[model samples]
Target: MELDRSGRVLAALSVAPALAMAGWLMAGLPLLLLGRFAPLPMLLLGVPAAALLCWAGTRQAGKVVEATVWQVAGVVAVAAASAVFNGVMHSEQLIVRRDPATYAQYAAWIAGHGGLPISVQPEAFGGADPWLLFEGVGFYGVDGGVAPQFMPGAPMMFALGHWLGVPFAVPAVLGGLAVLTVAGVVARLAGARWAVLAALTFAVSMPILYTSRTTFSEIPSLILLFGGLALAHDALGRPGWGRGLLAGLVFGLAVLVRVDGLRDVLPVLAFAGLLIAMRRSSRSTGSARPYGALGLPLAAGLVAGAGLGMLAAYLLARPYLSYLSSSVRPLLFICGGVLLLTLAGTAAAPMLSRIRLPRWAPAVGAGLVVLLMAALYVRPWLQTVTRDPVTPEDRRTFAMIESIQRANGMPADGRLLYFENSLHWVIWYVGLPVVVLATIAAAVLVRRLLRDGTPFDWLLPLAVIGWTTVTTLLRPEITPDHPWAARRLVPIVIPGLILLAAYALSRLRTRRWWVTAAAVLVVLVPPAVTSIGTAFTPVERGEAAAVEAMCAELPPDASVLVVERVTGDRFTQLVRGMCDRPAAEVKRAGAETAPEAEVRRLIERVRAAGRVPVVLAAAPGQVAPYGPATHVIALVTRQDERSLVDAPNGTWGLGIDVWMAVAR
Candidate 1:
């Protein structure tokens, strides 16, 4: 029977859900069924799943049902293939780098408690307060409020992992699914071949691979970003307030996933704004659609507000809103306004009509207000909390600026160590240049679209550019640090850059060679450097190896005293290993927190315990102020070995190896 166009579309949509479900089940079943008993099962399952998806997606069906079936199958195939590869190999590395100890502890927590509890785990680590901030032991009963650093999407993802009886690596599998879906959607929007290229590029790209494997919020944030872009793209294809609102909803969800998540909202706002601009620009005389002018912003604001409100509600109920005050409030408000304005302006229209510069005067006023707030609120708050002036010498700021300067090849004393080695942690390893290049490419495409209105042109690049802006700006020098910004931003920038390149390439239809070469240069350089670095010199591997070596030396009865400037992962690992047995690391006759004198007293108590004292890491140039009675045992490297010694005095200088007595 020949189906009508609407009938075909219905048929296509109707069959998609089943195909999607089947594909999902097929992709994850191996991991779930084998339960790490056989990695081969996962590899084997991937082949048929992928083949089925490919076959179904490629098949020609006159009706929408057939087309949709093909789409679902293709998406499933890609996702399943990626999942199998990720589940078998990359997930372990991600887990190790991001939260090796946490996963181990989670296993222990499960064993001890027999299951996860509805409330927070009393003994969980990874956040400030054990009971309030951490809901460890994998997935089930995890409260979104527990991990202030992690977006709710990832943990909610992990919760599914717990439900499915999969390892912590399972979240990476889910992330792969999102990545694959994004590529597929992009491909369909562009072309199937283009989709495959994008997927292949994303898969091989170091930044995407690094994020896809980790349990960090970046992957989930990217998923939300993609979801928003896809929704916004669909909304633009057919304009309706409901579609715009739906776009807003996706954007809101993105922010709830991560504050940087608001970046994806830009295209939604921009596209809407462009519509209004087109409408106004089409008019010959003065307009009375001022209320219409507010439509896009109002929608975006309500959506963003809903997201913020949801997060605030979650935080307030959890007593987290108090984390914001005069100093911090200003930053939040500024970030919120900037995010809102960017989204609104992006959607409002490209015209300089009714909603002119003066109406946006409030944003300028808000900018001044933000600056004043930063000066007044942040300065005093920092002084009070830091108990020192916010100067160049301020350790945290000094270390942060130093790291950035170091990456840029500026002079630094290197005397003070960076917190979490965040300087190297982000720029060097995360490979931010990828997004930066993407930004240039996006700008090129945006300008092209401005000079020439190309349908389907504005959506992807605008979304990406918006996302890139958010990613770049949201980084703040604070306690938690903005470590995930690079990865979270990658999804934004890469797609944006690629879309821009696609546009640029389109422009070079007659003269493809030179333009194509330039486009290739744009895409290749950042990721190439990143790829080379990751392959040749993996920081996570080196760091993990050092930490593993340290953990190996912890004797059943021995206590580890970390000194100097070992990374946070190093200390946290030592604690997890020691805590595995009641008295391995911190269990001693006595304990003390901070203060040199109190620590000295604690050292005496360890002497009383009749156990050998071990110092895990000594920061370069830091002396423990130990009395002469304290003797040096063996020096422990951050890698858990005794071969490396502390730097002597300079930034590279290690600390001393000290024990209360040779014999306790």
Candidate 2:
């Protein structure tokens, strides 16, 4: 088979992101196994490995696929342009926001030591280290030491960038690749015209812009998720175990990047099951099957690969699990069960396919099962939100939100559903009209998929959109501040909606050029403008400087105590990681004032241990009681104005004052 210029460009676009993501995942595995994740070695080893995989996947297609040199150049040019744009929009300094700061610390540790740290310094406050409880800082205090409480995926990617002297590079690059991946998928599913439109739409969506530029895990997760979907789609189309194994491998990596990815990928699992079933049923005809000789192996490989990948992730995250007071045994059982069930289903496919059923039987059965499962998962969450008192987790999140509402002078005790529009939050960032059109497109696609048989092409997208949208809407946790909550939708909603919109536009059948152009502009322009404008806006300035200055003034042997006042202390990780200081938060939960006696005791203990003690407070008054003997230095941090919209004003990086008492 031969390909046109656009087709060839689309192919290249697909190939590059897949290669990049595969390289990233492959590079981390060896380092992880060796207990040392060095960036230079990963890059050196990963590049060749990725190239070989790409070459092997494409070598057998037996097609003279060629695009104009200009076309290939355009793909590279666009990817580069998007990367630069994202990088410019990213955080200006080392992030000090709670989660980002935590991930940054993980990245820093990985980059510096080439492995997970044994323990972070103990909290300076009265309780056992806050990190142990996954409080105050983004760490879990374990057995007198602290470890990061996040999955290793994003941090591993960040560590790679840290080695290259730019910690933000990984996400920025992945963000650009995500855009290309969207375009590539659209091109394959629709056409090149629509692919361009899809790429442009994704590139400028606010959710994409925001998540890609931050240390948020969503960007890397989306890259792997989308890349895996694209590859899996290709494997399904062509009968080959290699492609299937590769797709499964990529999907597994996505799970490693974020545990929630297991939920995100359920549709892929179902789709693989369907494919195996179809292949089994067709085998009786003695006809050519699309999956060729290795059809059964290919299907089995995807399931096995994903299972192993998730198991690997669970193993790597044992420290985090210990901190959460959870065990790996349950996760192991789950993984083993999934693998067993999948293998059993595949083995039984031949027997099952022989049994006659109505055409709609599978769809109806699957829908009912999913509905039942969702109900089971959501029942307790709904009760907590409505009938039951707020749980501790919800209370903490509510406290944070209430603090923000107070700072912004918004009403307290608003309706429970005040932020319940989580389902529709995309409309705020991408604009309402675009959302309406995307909805229409999605509806149209669903109708077609149901009316016609569920082709493999449509099955994955439909499942992803349906499952993700449902879960996102029913998300039981207190809706985090607006745009940030939208981060959860980035790996699914933005891309899914963009693809649907592109499909809608492609089906327009109108020959009028002006009409097509107008339609495209209406769907694409507003969100693009909003996102691009936000990208150019600077945020979080002076934060790095403040942390640096504070660190510089502290004695080398000083231990730091962060007193959580109005802001509720999330800066311990920043001090611990950025300032290279042992830091802890003074527990002031629901307290009217600082625990002066406890604070003094901790200070005395630090002194007795031959370390100077410093107290850092978000509000100056928190340290006021220390009085004449106390020396205070003011530190200022500027926050991203955008973050305050959903979060407390003080949640973002803020200016703080550090105080220390002199022994007289």
Candidate 3:
């Protein structure tokens, strides 16, 4: 009985990874499939898929727990870290007013008026609107036009939020949770020590923590990308028909999450094919059974995933077909490449089996995969190569990068609820190719791990380093060594940290445990302090208070214009609710200023609109000439840096300080 129980446990352990992969894929696959057929198919497919996943996951939990404590701990830690990061840093107000809200309202405006489409033609060439979140409409800058450049993922998430709640912060918080799920899942795959490191890296290394609380879909898409990879790995390692089916489901689901995620899925399928090839080659004599067993299930899975994804795309596109020309073409290119690669990989398998192959064969096979990845990287790479004029978006992004590039740049203004524009710079500078490279490297590492050396894997670290390197290269802001800004490197930070921590624990050297403990303390402190500070203080309060103070100082009848930083969502709520403010409030104000000298003209217009108009500037130094001011009030001030706040305002406030200026 004892021996039988042990054997059963071992058998279950061997199949666990595949089972997990299949379960997740099964859960997400139907939604993707349903999407392809019709939106209503979601009810037909999702209920079944979700039920299977839950059942499979629950059944496996006991066996997984029995296999290793590290797995449990890693999963819990990654999830906990993500939760802690967002829980501490995220807030309701921050979520609703973050950058995306500006776009959300614009989308809503379009939806309200016959679902107008927005165009996204940048004056500068090589500008990125790569994802096409709003290809249904165009994002024509801040005009709230019909055509916005945003992708469907973000708008869909926002739309869901609008249907469900007020504040819209709930979606942002949920976005953070999605990020947490990715971190947790990745950490678990990396192992316990690495998992903790991954969590730390995610928490502090990259902008994942920051995005957790924002309405942005990038991080959520990234999480889905990782999920696809993990599930594929699980399926490949298990070698079961059901698992392969699940992998297909996951591959389809990934495409549904974000278009970029599809890039990561390619290498996973290639790796799976490699496994299938290996299994085929290992069989003695050409046997039909082996070929059928390996190829049929995999082919079925491929069809399911691809078919489902295509179905979803068509269904989603049905409502708005005209705007999809540019968007749909890229997917076609991807599909064509996938088909060509699959054929090539299949054709080359027999040749790869030969011991004394043609001299150019290895180079050719290797070169093909490399070229495919190179092609994918090219567009994003070129975008980074070109630089644009530094506007408000540019400066804000630069400051974010500088925070990471410079050690002391973490602004003391507030800890939590601050948006990092630098992350975009990092991603662009870094290139989207790293996602592909990391997935490939991780797959290779997993293969090596199963073959058995020390059971240590390099996938996690490769992912982190590759992402960080790409991010650092593309970003105009941030040097390589910025400490607080180090969050940009979160992809690899946790994995790298885990290696160090693991090494410390395993080392027989004197006081090694102390070193590990100290490392944990160091990693835990920054986030802990950030969380504490964020909980007690509001990140938006400085700007919010400034806006409130500026409003209070103005007369009820006066026309006040905020001639700074153009327009964005941060000021949206205030402007929209202006009519609802108290009796002492001024008539509704507006935000004005061009990215260039036209801002001065706009300020002049405000001065002309009323007698002794109160023009409050926040980032005054960014603008020039301070233009003739009767009474200028500086609601916020930064260091002696060139910005809108530094323009020679007659009165200024420090912290909560108030100052008054007499009309000239």
Candidate 4:
């Protein structure tokens, strides 16, 4: 089991692809910003940049023994298999109701046009009728443009799939990339041997699988975060400016994928500052060991990455940014305060280092960690977190909760967020054995750090993972559902806990096969089986074909006016983007109803604009009155079910019908 310098270099090669994947994602930002997202140009710049990043991340990796040939190959095989399986079974979430479709459509427009502010094409719709709304769910209608929700980072990566003519393949690759990065971190932090165990445990979990099979931002964010972790671990040892710069860039670029990434990397910001502070302290002052020379570049890269993300948000996706202003404002404030505190800590480093700690402090801290977990479990009995349905979104959330409650036969309380059961959600996904092992590892690691901070590599990662995990467990902010709510845990908690849990298992000095097998079975079985119902069952099949057929029916220059509720909710963007037509959904005359007067007036306007007007509906009867009804889309698929009170067991039936009439 002994390793040499060659082992260290081999470990670097093992993780190099993971870092390159992350770098490629980051590299797309410039192309997207410049509105020149051509494949040739993107690959030309991205390939070499990715290669450079791999070199930077791995150059100093030779300082640590983190992986072996067998271990690396084993982890890679599992990761490759995950990517292929996920690709084969990937969901065709082309219609907009949730995030996946939003991302699909977003990436679609970007790939097709290589620009932002998706044109509303008001000229075809007779100059923006008051009776029409250009936006669909997750797509916002700005002054004269359509904007996609969420950060552009994941979509930027997904755009490659469209450029390559295999859109789902991007998610599959990212899913696999996520696995490799997880293995890399486990290899570096715990030991080289435990990497595959951690990878297997993580790859089979429902959250990882679920996010990977669809276009969720979580997978890309997870990859970037963990890829950065792999780089940062190596940099912490050799303290090269390039290594720290790349690590911090990817870490901060995660914010480009998800806004909450800012919150997640707060510890990184703090750790960078701490490193600078310790670097200034002298041996005469009995200061802790300096972290060589990593802090400044790491801090600079983080700031630069964050600045780029915010700039992209401001320039390209303004409507989405405006909508998230309330949440974004507070996060910005918190970051500012943390930066100020870091500066203060640096100034006071010498004074801070002279302080001493009690030997029993580690034991006390460990006991407190256990106490916190126990308290979270006991919290439901004492507290019920609820908010009044005051805002429009709050009311919608309340209604969704009530419907889910009724479906599950639980008491209907629209106000409940179910934040109290957060830890239980973790159990439902990763199992009790993992939770036990992770808790033990975290507590023991904390104890070791306090007693003697010799396990120096664990410093920044533990700070980052532990902080995000605990904060999220305390207030998940997402709706309480099996996989939907589990998005909060996907990026960090699931993988972080599994890695630590594996590290804990590696500590067991047992030679017995039965003992090892029992441990593996206990830690791995529950999570792998938890998602049994849906892992093999693909959702939203044949949806892309249905959409294509629907799009093909409409002429390239047709102006679509959707008059039905379901049709508008589902096909607004599909018509606008895929059909390459100007599409608008009439504003509701009543509860999810289109006003006949407005619909007819819009039809006249479309005619006046010298374009074929198409009236779209979910039924033959709804569109037949305009002209002769043409059946465009008939889709029958399954969708993931929502649950708040109890865990979701399976999916529900989904049916989509679109009918259109071309008015001459």
Q: lDDT per model, in order?
A: 0.40, 0.62, 0.39, 0.82
Once fitted onto the true fold, the runs of candidate 4 whose alpha carbons sit more than 4 angstroms away are 1-10, 283-290
Return the TM-score for candidate 3, rounded to 2 decimals: 0.52
lDDT of 4: 0.82
Candidate 3 wrong stretches, greater than 4 Å? 1-52, 56-85, 91-99, 102-148, 158-190, 279-339, 356-512, 518-664
Record all residue pairs in model 4 with backbone atoms less than 3 Å apart, i.e. clashing: none
Candidates in order, TM-scores: namely: 0.53, 0.82, 0.52, 0.96
**Tens digits of per-residue lDDT for model 1, 75-146:** 456566666655554433212223333443333333232222222312221122211112222222224322
Cα-lDDT of candidate 2: 0.62
The worst-scoring run of ten residues by lDDT in candidate 3 lies at 640-649
Global CA lDDT computed for model 1: 0.40
What CA root-mean-square deviation does each model show from the true structure? 11.9, 5.3, 12.1, 2.0
On lDDT, the leading prediction is 4
Output the better candidate (2/4) by TM-score: 4
lDDT per residue as tens, model 4, 549-620: 888888776999988887787788878887788888998876566877778888899888999899998888
Cα lDDT of model 2 by residue, 252-359, tens digit: 666667766776776666667666766775776555557433345444645564564566555556566554333345544654675577667767876775666667
lDDT of 3 by residue, 577-625 (tens): 2211111111123434323333334334434544333333334342234
Q: Is candidate 1 or candidate 2 better by lDDT?
A: 2
